[model samples]
Target: MRTALTIAGSDSGGGAGIQADLKSFASVGVHGTSAITCVTAQNTRSVDSIFPIPVAEIRKQLRAVLGDFDVRAAKTGMLFSAEIVRTVAKELRGTSFPLVVDPVMVATVGARLEQDDFADALGDHLLGLAALATPNRFEAERLSGIRIDDVESMEAAARAILRLGPKAVLVKGGHTKGVLVDVLYDGRRMRRLRGRRYPKTLHGAGCTLAASTAAYLALGRPLLAAVESARRKVAAGFRQSYRAGHGVEIIDSHAVPD
Candidate 1:
């Protein structure tokens, strides 16, 4: 089986972050490995607390997996600080495989994942290193300084983010109403990925999307094809979502192909 690694935080709630990344990798038929950077005391309702493991331990976890496994691809979730980001970026630089970085700034509940100051470094240092950077409307607005209210605005956001130097940028449109349209911009082209919007959110949709993209890239899909494949898979995951908690349904096993 192919191996993929998820370097992310663990959510006891099992909805988003590392839990979601593992489920996504498994659902996609890739053997999943993980490196936990932080642990959160979260339930379906909300995040109550978080414990950050030492950066040394985080590096150890990363070293253990990347050292042994022929890791095909990797995805990163919440690093939560500039030092941790720098550590992860430094370690990943030597790998031949593709890396997908999800700039997880805020949680679903509006909690800040990183301090305000680290936001700039995250964009400057980490994003430019990624094969792909997945950002939501808010994150795009923050990273790209572009507010997206329409398709044109979304394209502008994608372009601005691309300038930060990721090979590509996928701007998720969950923050937009009417339809769940995502805008992906590579230096060569601009494409809008559209899915019929799901009114209720299934937990970990973005994480699932990003993880699936990494898995697909590992399987040799092109960047656009990777995003397209993952986007479709994530859409079905949302459609098949089930109650993992009282608050929201999770993408769960739906990351698997039909």
Candidate 2:
């Protein structure tokens, strides 16, 4: 079976982070491997605390997986610090497989996930190595310094982010008011992917999208097709989402039909 890896934190709630990534990978029929960067005490409602795994031990996990498995593609989620971000970047440098970078900044419950200086490290070391970078509206605004009020500004932000060296950028418009639209740009052209706005706020939607894309890439699909497939998968997952806790609904990507 083809394999994919997720370099991310472990969410005890099983709603997001490594748990979500692995579930998304399995849904797409890809073997999921992971190198946990941190462990978080979080649930649907809040993130109480986070403990970063030692950089040396994190490297060992990466080496073990990379050395033993034919990892066809990979995605990164919550790297809690600048050092961990740089470490992951260094490990993935020059790798042949596609990488989907989910620039995770804040949790679904409005808690900050990354360190204050993490953004600089991510932009400098990691974004350049991505095959695709998936950032939501707020993250796009932070990364591109452009406020995305409409499709035009979304495209502008994608363009600005593309200049940071990712092969493609998907500026997710999930935070917008009406019907959802995600602007995808691959430098040559821009495509607007539209999806319905579900009533419930689902946790881990972004992680699922990026992870599914990585799994599809591991399955040898092209970048555009993989992204489209991933989006559809997440949409379906949201439809079937259930409350795993008293707070937000968990996006059950595994509940979707393969």
Which candidate achieves the best TM-score against the true structure? 2
Which stretches in model 2 have alpha-carbon errors above 4 Å? none
Evaluated at residue 101, the lDDT of candidate 1 is 87
- The residue pairs that clash in candidate 1, if any, are none
lDDT score for residue 250 of model 1: 75
How does each model score on lDDT? 0.84, 0.93
Candidate 1 lDDT (Cα, 0 to 1) = 0.84
Best by lDDT: 2
Q: What are the per-residue Cα lDDT tens digits for candidate 2 across 1-258? A: 999999999999999999999999888789999999999999999999999999999999999999999999999999979999999999999789999999999999999998999888888999999999999999999899998899899999999999998999999999977778999999999999998888877899999999999999999999999998898899889889998789999998796545
Candidate 2, lDDT over the whole model = 0.93
lDDT of 1 by residue, 28-138 (tens): 678899999889888666778878779999999999998899999999998888888888888888788888989888777667777666678777677777889999988
